[model samples]
Target: MDEQTGSPDMATGSDRIAGDNIAAYASSAHSPTSESMMSGGSRNRKRSEVFATHESPYFFPAHQLYNVVSMDRSTSYTLKLAAKIDRGFFLASNDWTCYRRNYFQISACFFIPGLDTTQQPEVPCLLDYNGELLQVNRFLICIGAQIQNGDKAIELVQHTPKRDKGPQITPKRMPVRAGGDLSPGPTGLQPYVVTYERVQFKTATANNGKRRAAQQYYQVHVDLFAETDTGAQILVANLLSAPLVVRGRSPGHYADNEDDDAVAAAAAAAAGAGAPSGPGTSSSTPYPADERYPPASSSYRNDSISSSNGGDYSYYPNYGYNSSSYPYQSLGSASHMATQDYREDYHYNNNSGRHDSESYPASPLSPSGPHPHAYMTPQVQHGFSPAASGAASPDMYSPSGFPENGGGHYQYGSPTYPQYPQQHPQDQHHHYHQEGQQQLNGQYDSYNGGQQYDQETQDHATQLAGLRIHSPVSPSSPLIGSPTGVTPRRQSFSSALSSKKAGVGIAGDRSSIGSTRKTRSISMSGITKRAPSKTRTSRTVPATPTKEHHSNGGALGSIGGVLGGIGGLGGIGHGVKGLGISSDRIPENPMEDQQS
Candidate 1:
């Protein structure tokens, strides 16, 4: 779109370009500076810069986190856990205060194939955050709250995990370290009894990028169960009742060092005596083997917990502590004494279209490869360009890190593990200082006493700011006057008036029966009025072409600018002639309708 208009380019350009011949715009015969083709330094960067702004706002909103699952018609269920640390914290809350304070909401859109009609299933009171049954539906959930009526919404199917009784799969035991810290080898640990089922989403292909996008989601269903002593259960209840804490441990780390051989021997010994236990075996008291391993949460477990007394237990320091009368309290309950920890991991699909790869532009001062210290590393072969190859130049590397042969810029990598060329500390400081100065000078439009503007306004301002371009016309005389002796400003005013008159002419012309035939042909042809000649050349007394008039290549170049000369005039004239009309056909003076 023209920079002056605050609308999308397609909205404005569609009408003009659709009626005009597409071939005309697509033709390669036009000069380099023609407005039809995007060029010039600022014009090329505008689209890229706007895209960057949309993907990376000045600051991210707390509630704007999003995740997407791809599902097809064959899939009927999907399981999803909150990904972000802050998001997980809110979802793990039992008091519902997090929901109230943060206006927590999750939006999921499902589409299935071949389903004419379906009602949202009634939310069941099945499981609490602590892996216990709710017993009663007391939590306020806006069920089946909103559904889009289009083809995208009706075909969706989703399945949340249910709390159920299953055979408690217990881990084998190995030697327990002094403090449950498994060293390099031979630590006795047991696996917890947790089972997970697959969840799938089924929907018809609908509103994705194109015909290839499926309109459904699918996931594996999972249920986590653990048999615990009163101490461990109390600790589990505490974690479930409060905000989730990612303990910074890997998911597989806990089960890694368990003594599987010893646990197998123990299981064999128990089976010989007929290990009497039913499914969901926590009730059985035949043996006290459950306390051998701490009851920890797993991926299969619903990441929420709650207690019968749902008051503000989180605020109390000793809320999770077991009864003071218990004998183990003297040494602290096994739950409080264990070295158990919680850890959260953020995983994102880098292949998705919406992901941003770089947090900062490339550093101009760096000579390193994407790997840190790659330039100076002795392990890598010496491939640095020699000083004779112009390696010392800051502009040697393109922003994308390939040779600067005027190619397009490339993104560094995903935000999580960005592969950036190493930059010196001084370069980083310079970039930060430049950004700070821009903020101080009001370039960001977002630093007004620390208050934030609306997202829409910020987006609009960003687009506007990026649209600025360096004009080819000089400040001394910006307008290119017509060759027919009319002043440029007068011609512009006349053109504006002519545009208004064309509106009335079109309306009146459409109404008149006599003009219908001509109007129809004109409309179908989409004929535009011929514009005045834009070519002119400076003259000298000896009938010789002035040096200022004829630039390189025997063309009428620009009369005032660097390219100003007679060489440019020929190109412009040739372009004008190619439009199927001559300069003589243009009106000397445009007439406006008397209706004002």
Candidate 2:
């Protein structure tokens, strides 16, 4: 019940009587704020922490001293004993008291953090109860009872706690622990054994005007067993008195430990032996081991002791002793767990995709390479002019030490790896003659790998070859093709032959060429390959006729005219050969093409 409600009875029935015991409030004066309770934190500390640091506002520690509520000086209660251990033997007592001045009532019941009700680790108290017999019952439990010399006698009760407000004032009829069952009462007024002790909860000054001693009420603790010289003994010791009851217990094992079984077995064996016993104990003993369990009380045998330890392995914020006495909680919903796992997988898949460098953009710091460090390394053995070569500067080439594609930039099948040269427009026909000759002679394979050259690759190679043609026989020689418009030579034939011999690589007189027109055709059709240059030029300069020839070569002067007045190199070549002038060179017998 909520303490704020202040109902007439907060909790009714046995729940109230067994609600919070005196052990829950022994340190009520120093009770922690409601926030400090073990909702869930480092709550499963050692048991010593409970007694020292914990407190409840309305409970007293159990197994401690308790004071009687009221006592009457006018009445003197008498003590008595039971006749013998016999069933259906109706016996009454004048020993027990339920009268007003002798009986007590509870004023409050609230819990303090002390120990659990299960008594798992060890037995704790049942506090805030009245040991008073407010009503009479046939099965009276004589508290502080003893057995000696085959007779039962009542022992004196001891303890002194103040009479304070508690929860249950009447007799409590409930199990010792929350989940256990209560044994049935014997007769109409069957009572079970119980006792009480006292505990000091709080004591301080109270003042209406000036300071004064507080009119304080101490806590009372209830106990289930009493202590004796023989050993610790329960008040309601044995209740299985019937014969049929004995037969029922004969089959089942109640105790987990073999020790209890041995004790019971030993007692049974001792009784059955009956080796001529004494007169008073002469009657045959029945199932003497049939001892009744404490009614409405928890078992303190503690079968699972390992759970109570607060060691490093056992204690955690979520488990240990706290879990044993309280309800546990689940972590989260199923969907939430699935969502978290999916998020992790999503990130992993994306990362795995990027494991290939081709998936991402290139780095800005360094570029990929022909050589390992192509972008920045110097070229020490550059064999040709940059313009002629159609190559990037030496600084653009990579060093041998680095990867060909140093920056991981290029995708598969990049155009950068092949160094295809650019074509020079002026040299196309020149290279074409040489290329056709090679094709006829089966000299070199086509640069295009037997396939036709793509426009780009053809352009590059043509430009490179055109720049290299600085031949000894300069096409710019005046007599070869003059600006005076393809006129006959002014000098003698010997001078021309000597000049030709000195300027070109042929050995015999020019007359030997007359024997084979096919050989002449071969020479006219192709330019012989030149030897390699000793020192490469850096600048690329185009060779051949000047711009004037290119501009006027397209126009023909007449049918027999050789030099075209206008147009490109092709037009000029065709025009020169059409006339019987022998535009390239005259045969040794210059009269031959003239005679045709």
Candidate 3:
């Protein structure tokens, strides 16, 4: 309703739209995935080639319990909660956002207590991620983490230092305790997160002449976390004892608790009036719940300004989605009674949360049972029960579960958590090359000492020898590439030999070398061979006696022919004088006589 623009204030409507746009634009800016720290924005960290784009959970988990100095009452206290979630790790509108757990990747991290010298405190030194001052190997959960988890459950696993195709480590389910504030309030939720900021008055001062200097201060953005699983919630409870809450500080200055703590408080007051507290245990109450998973309504029941009992809380009951601690005060309501009744349930782990391997004991038989005051009444929930939670069993004590920090607090990659078995930084280093098409180091790739594609070639035809590829070839082979990143064409090499009998080959007979042609050469073995010539031809003229070389000393000659010798032997021939024939009967050929 603008007074000047009589047409019903379009400017005012536009203002509303602009405000919505701004809110939408910045809604997820603070999430751990998108946080500047994980985006290679930290001054202490250099760009990592191993991890080009930042992973979803880029920071490590740091529990305050492990940090002895952080627990001191003199400095500010922080409750860091980490949970495992899916890969994307997007913040959830419900279920207090948590990261998916990967036991293999879970490790403990720690930082120096609050800043003692300044108004604010940071872990004394810079921690890249995980518990490491260096970021390269932070995301990897060492072999020790698996071994530790194995000791707690009935699962066998082994870890190797090199890149070998070995069996993977399969661990048992995480041990989750059964007893806790199943009320869905501060203690029951899986892990609650509320983002808020505070301006430090100690750091503020004004110095511009007496003209009423505007207040100067630094606004501290606080990403608060609280445990949900009884396994981890117990750890949180041991740290926060009693602190009276201040009712009026900076009111909901940031985003209000998405759970609507105020509306829930009014509902609690109504429920309290309707159902008066009795001496009955939580089992008799209508809201029997499992500590791990609680009903939606029961979650914020204790969210009222201040409960009668000062059980652990996420923020100041009265202050703006206030800080974890509050101004001291006394309680006088059923809330106070409730806190007193359930105090004994908080102690799940010791100062270090390590279980004695030699004498691990179930929660029921733990010689070191928590203080008698630290107990919770039995509560029920759908699909779960006290016995079903087997988390209290000694075998389930040490699980490889990651604590989550809601709103991308970087639980897995983000904080200081439990001390995992120490891993040699050297073991985790890996060479990262450009991820496109990689070249084969050797065509004869070997596995377990056996050859791959490259092997010896069989012999070829009789005329042509075969190629026998031995293990080592000359480096000058055409296939070998230098720094040019190029490969030459593959040449076919084989031994070719001349025929053994001129017309023969290993496969079959070959065409005869023409009478004019002959082949001879050396092969891969360096042996030389020559081909035979064409077949012999028949003689045309008769040889003379004088030209003949006699083997028996006499030369066989040809004489003139006589036809009547048989008749002369009968004594009727004219050529024989003793018989009846004369010399005229046997005569030489006239041609022969003429020649004589």
Candidate 2 lDDT over residue span 363-414, tens digit each: 0000111111111101011111112122211111111111211222211111
What would the per-residue lDDT of candidate 1 be over residues 1-596, giving only the tens digit for each residue? 11101112212232121112211111111111111112222442432221110000000000101111122223221111111101101100000011111111111111111121111111111222233322221111000100111001111111111112111111111000001100001110100000011111122111111121211111111111111211010001101111111111221321121122123222322222122111111122121232111111111111011111111111111111110100000001101111111111111111112112111100000111122111110111111111111111111111221111122111111121111221111111111111212221221111112222122222332222211111111121101110111000000112222334333432224434554332211111001111001111010000111221122212111111100111111111222111111111111111110010
Model 2 vs. true fold: TM: 0.13
List per-prediction Cα lDDT, in the order shown: 0.14, 0.15, 0.16
| Model 2 worst lDDT window (10 residues) | 330-339
Error of 1 at 359 (Å): 18
By TM-score, the better pick of 2 and 3 is 3
Q: How many backbone clashes can be found in candidate 3?
A: 53
Model 2, stretches more than 4 Å misplaced?
1-44, 48-140, 147-154, 162-195, 198-596
Model 3 lDDT per residue over 461-497, tens place: 2101101111011122111221111110110111122
lDDT sort, best first: 3, 2, 1
The parts of candidate 3 lying over 4 Å away from their true place are 1-67, 70-596
Error of 2 at 498 (Å): 99
